[model samples]
Target: MTFMKLKFGTAVLLGSLLIGACPALAEAVLHRGNSGEPQTLDPSQTSLEIEAFILKDLYEGLTSYDAAGRIVPGAAESWTVSDDGTVYTFKIHDKANWSDGTPVLAEDFVFSMRRVEDPKTAAGYANILYPIKNAEKVNKGELPVDQLGIKAIDAKTLEITLERPTPFFVELLAHQTALPVNKASFEKNGADFIKPGKLVSNGAFELAEHVQNDHLTAVKNPDYWDAANVKLDKVIFYPSEDQAAAVRRFEAGELQLVYNFSADQIERLRASHGDEVRVTAALSTYFYSFDTRIEPFKDVRVRRALSMAIDRDFLSKEIYSGAQLPAYSLIPLGIATYGEPARPDFADWSQLDREDKAIELMKEAGYGEGGKPLNIEIRYNTNPNHERVAIAVADMWKKTFGANVTLLQNDISAHYAYLKEGGKFNAARAGWTADYADAENFLAINLKKNPVFNYGRYDNPEYDALVEKSYNEKDPAARSKIMHEAEAIVLRDQPIAPMMNFGQLWLVSKKVKGWQDNGSNDHLSKYLSVEE
Candidate 1:
């Protein structure tokens, strides 16, 4: 292991070398590539990909998770959890300030949370704030927005009250959707606060410039509370959809960091860079969701038959090229109560017997080998690998069940629109990366009433009750049991056919130090320093 002590002066020396020595620069350009462009820079309206990149530079919540998945202080210097577990009091860091030199006050959090739950703002992930007392009622317009439970007791102190005890509440606050915003800037700019040269940030970096769909540049924030610990002077982010081209750029020394490496590139980079090519299991599950409200799929037998006909293992190996693991359930391994090898008995749809059973079920559902082909459309985003996987599955379904399946490929924005508006498609590819280290993050979203991300509309009163019960149960063992039952219910319904667990692949230059990959695939560039 390389044991180089990091200090303020040492960081300055190394940063100088990064800017002065390498072709890309010792300044750590932090070039990143993704298939989807950042939809919005507004912390409340963006998705995970944009949020993860913006988090390094522009936002700060009360708490954050470390690389080890432990909770740590961020904007809040310290906090106290009430004995009843319903109230939390946070002390803001005295040194924290916005990029414009205004102090980041506790009232900023109050205004930010209110803005997210306000129905007019239409924050996509606003359901994440449901734990706050009366948040749901306020969001639904059943109660006034000011009735929400968060309050700024003073300039530097914030108090929050929840409807019930929630162990994951602190972790939930760490999410970008819950990050604090400057009330003054927000009121002045309204919806235009995210525009270039108009944004103010409280995180480790400040937005230097932004060119839509092309590139965004951020420089280190000198006013950040932990600015002394941040090493890089600037980070340049590029939004590119072509993974192969991104890898070419990395190989040509035009970029220093790249995410979502192609399978062929992974093999070649492993041969050359060895340990520099890193792959880790991500807390994500890619699945095919059947709109239960749509025709033909309303039948549970049809859903189960579709799930059984496809082979998850074959798709993972052939299409993913050993980049992912076959998934059997919504909750990926290593989450709460799911770390055990054999806890829940989700159906093993990959088995050979299951294939035979699927054929039988198809015949019973009035579609068989010699009957009329079950015409269906399978939708997926236009990533090279995702489209390839959809094509492979379409072929598999045609061969196994004699179902005539058509593949529809759309760009990321269009795909999201189709899912959101309930467009006509028998089935579509979808996935969820865990927001926190909880099974609730996976199973809760599928509830019938969840407005944000629940595309399938799968609902069971029994399962919903169990999810609520687990949240309040203080006993770990009891909570685990309840969550296990909830997972069983979701798998049995098969609203979504679980296909594979994602594995994140990143190609980084050897000179980048302290860039540890986490289970969530979140890259914290603030903790990284370039070495000469």
Candidate 2:
């Protein structure tokens, strides 16, 4: 008990050491190995999934994800939707309080929603909130933040109106962008409120400290509305960019949960740790985006040829160790009710036929032994897995088109920031895990309206219209059909070349309880308990 209350810097160090030396001290302390350091703790300002993992514990949204990644009640005890299915009213429990013991009012949600869509705030994932009325306009600087459709009905009740009917609207609230900020703390400290000492969160845990490149610590929040049910006293997340070393740490008992270990280690891990090596199919796609705004790639033939030339089977079986399946379309299987996504004509072609056609396509695009030199610069984020994949793709490009290829690597944060901030490049690696199970979540990245996640800057009007039509369509079958059509257009245009459908390869310690494998791959620390 005494060791659990150690100060920030000292706690991360001595706690790990003391816990290892005294097994009794390790009870209720969880050391989670995260993919990388969070880019920012601010809900409105982050785009990375790693940051969402920590934010979910510190900030409860109107609706929240359960242990199974399904939508469930959170700060709002319950909510009702209008018969038209556009307006929603949420009732926050009077007992809901921030970490500082102040009541969480409905005005806080209104303020937070407005803040996230305010163009001045620059939320990278803002488009996800566009289902709310005027949210897109507000985020695009066309409308005033106050004009956003959220309203505080009373001190404890909140109402939100959507511009159009959205079936997935309730589930959308479970995203990190919908996490409310403590109005008092935010007003008092401004942007610094996300800092350790100033952040007044309302979830099961509160931020204790974040030592960059080391660990982020959160302790149980006594003031939380559901504090009585929270089992873990402290949650410490360690950024494990070097996953191999992280596996070593996991083997040494320094970390109870290690995520995204190198796939090449799957067999050895299974033999050694048994069920601790959690492997499952995930609704995620790893793809490379050709900068549609730039040349060589500006030609559709060049983009399609390069995409077809890559031997996805080799990448899946050889590089990923058969953990992932080769993907030919942006939408992966088992997403919502969208059914199977439509694939391009080349999807069923053999590798040999695809390569021969790729060569012919390259020649037609004026590359190969005659016209323009195909000097491709591929940019991928830092990770042993991503680097290996990039090198393999480079070799395939060289073999197929005799293209001069260069690979650019940057740290995770910097790499994504460069693409998101509109830095120019020829081809860049991009991966998407569905924010919701909907196909729109995957296909919407190519939408011109989504400048943040639309890294390649692709702006196809027909594709955009079909996606928008699906959102407003009432019939589920018709909506899914519209979305499927939208996916087809992107595949034909080849804005992004889908390489693989990810199989979530993770290591969850058997000692941790309440974890369920789900498509979205979100496991909240609040729902999990650490066992001795």
Candidate 3:
């Protein structure tokens, strides 16, 4: 109902243009600024937040987030959980229809569930569906794709069996990874199903054009289930990785919304645009993952020393201008269900004392000047903010540990590809935005089971066992406790050094309406309108 209430009073927009003796209405358009060029528009193939922002516009999942980031019914009109909480049944909305005028069926979701879990699909976040019975085994190639616990009970009814009692299953369903891909379109076009003419979306909008680095455009879908309530006629998403350029464009009135601008420009942007500038705490974490599969980093003392020596507080206050908060644990604070995640023992220590201890630890671990020279490379994506953060961290290591550090920069797409494809590296920058509200979503990244997300290749049998135990625990309180223990273990080992919890920054034009700040940071185009 929250989503229902967010809709504009009238779905239709009217703009008068005197055409000789008659008046014509202009098409309602929204110019949106996204972070970077998407690697792919395929929901299953994308791992970036920027891609998700657009995908949510083109695809509808069983559940979706509203303008306020609250979960709401989406493609599935209604769903019910079994008494045991291991099975879910969803009734597809009768009005749900793909862009091509085909009725959205339960079988569509069933096919998507199987494909995403199959080894052939190569979905980056395939592990997100691990809750489904035999889902993990199917993804791991131990089970057939047909073994994934999803079935079309009827044309409009879908049934899913879970491996265990998953409390966040509904929340996870709203993630972009869970969105259904039309089987007919995929089979017909092969990998090109995402092309403008081929992509058959079941959301409020459908892809109209994609101009790579320029912009991707989507026009309203007449066949959308709630088309009558959908206001925007078209939405243009610009890949604005260059924040300065994006800011200039926004100031020039070329864009109504810009995402991820330079944090240092906050004051000036706010001064110039007044209340148009926006900042909201994100349920996300930015960190550097160590290649634990390699030497030096394999040693806990060396890893801990490197992590402890870095002054996170300084980076948050100086580099990001308070746009982020110093993080000690990989999981961000204030996640629902799980409260106050465990932190490193050195978390409360003064920076001066921590640095001294770090030096001693490095020397003891056969690193630093007296021992082996710690030659390390810091890999990060090509963004001004990332470059500055990498340089600051590299400088800290050079000064404190007397280690030689090298920095490697790649574009957003290539940077993630290198890590996800299991490319060998020293230390690489990584950030995770929550796919759902669960702490397990964050902890699952470090699991040995998730190689794509677990770029560090951190394998701890005890930690993995604890996580598995939590999955089958059934009781919420007990599961939380077990997860806390597992997190404590990971923090102690420190395979990934927590840098900061993110605060998403954006610039919204005054012409834009229905923009609301949310912790999850999802502001769907369907809930927004623009006034000319």
Candidate 4:
């Protein structure tokens, strides 16, 4: 959350402005600065928030979120769940079609689901589909892809059977991973399917152009089923991780909306522009994951010491300008489903007391107090704020226990890839925004069998059992209790140091109407219109 002092390059801003200043569009064209480069355009492979911003517009899943963040029908007109609640039957909207006017059939969804389950696809988010019967087995190569419990009854009818009754299955459908992909386009284009003029999507907007780190443009899809309600003619996104650059582009009148304003500039912007500066307690947490399989971190004392040494209050106040909360658990405080947030074991300890305990624990682990110093490398994605936080945390560890901490910064995509696959870093930056408004979304990532998001490689059979049991437990109160137990175990082990809960800090032009602030931090252009 810490913002570093970085100058916005005038040349880069001008180049971006030139690309977005489309005079041909007489009515409405939205200019936005995406928070970071999209990790991937392929729906099944994408995991980053920046990618979700574009993917949600370019592809329509069975369900979608309205401007209010309420679940609504998208590709499916309606769906019915069986008495057992393990089977779902969806009635596809007859008018839904690809940007090219080809009918979007139920078969398309089946193909996409199967592809995600196929081991050959190597989709990072394929585990999201594990609720479906045989999906986990298919992903592990024990079962064939054809065994996945999704089938197209006909061109307009689709049915799916789950391993158990999943209360959040409907919400899961709204996620990009559940969206359909054109099988023909997939085979024909291979890796180039999402490129300009090569993509075929069934959403309000279709891919018009994409240039790696520079920009991604989407034009209104004429063949979209509900094109009449779509207000924007074109939306241009400039991918950037620099908060200063985003703020600069927004002030220059080149961008209508921007993400992650510098902490220092927020107060100035609020005083000058007032309501234009939007800040909401987002359902997300900014944290760090430890490589639990590695040495030093393998010891519970070392992990707990590191977690206790850093001051969460300092991070929320001094660094983020009090824009976020001091998080003590995986699930953010606002989530009512979890009842109450679980306080970490060190929550009650004063800063001095925590520092004393951290020193003692480091000694017990045979590290500090004239013993061998604990050498740890902290890796994070390239962002001014991320770098600032890393520097602060490293300093805290050095001061508290005389530990040697090295900060390694990589490109956003590369950073995540290294954490998930490279397995070389001691600790890495991590964040989780609720995919659905449930604690399960945050807690499920730590499951030992979940190959997708568990970058830390934390394994506890007892903890995993509690989480797995919560899925099938029908009683809301019972589920919450089980989840709490699982969270307590995680806090005790300290696989991740819960840093700070997120408050989305962004700027939206006052001229933009119908922009609703929601916990999801969703600002889909379909619901917005420009006054000019």
All models: lDDT? 0.79, 0.90, 0.91, 0.87
Q: For residues 1-532, could you state the per-residue lDDT of candidate 3 as single tens digits?
A: 7666555423322212243334224578999999889999887888899989999999999999999999999999899999998999999999999999999999999999898988988898898899999998999899999989999999999999998888889988999899999999999999999998999999999999999899899999999999998889999999998888998999999999999888888888888889999889998999999999898999999999999999999999988889999999988887879999999999999999999999989989998988988999999998888889999999999999888999999889899998999998889999998888888988999999789999989999999999888888877888899999999999999999999999989899999998999998888999998887
What is residue 49's positional error in candidate 4, in angstroms?
A: 0.5
For candidate 3, what is the total of clashing residue pairs?
Answer: 0
Task: Tell me the spans in candidate 1 whose CA falls farther than 4 Å from its real position.
Answer: 1-28, 67-69, 337-350, 370-372
The regions of model 4 sitting more than 4 angstroms off are: 1-27
- Per-residue error for 174 in candidate 2, Å, reads 0.6
Model 4 TM-score relative to the real fold: 0.94
**Quick one: how many clashes does candidate 4 have?**
0
Candidate 2 lDDT, 312-429, residue by residue in tens = 9999998889999999989999965888789988999999999899889889989976768899999998888899999999999998888999999998999999999999899999
Count the clashes in each prediction: 5, 0, 0, 0
The segments of candidate 3 whose C-alpha lies over 4 angstroms from its true place after superposition are 1-24
CA-only RMSD, every prediction = 5.9, 5.7, 5.9, 9.7
Q: Clashing residue pairs in candidate 4, if any?
A: none
Looking at candidate 4, the ten consecutive residues that score lowest on lDDT are 1-10
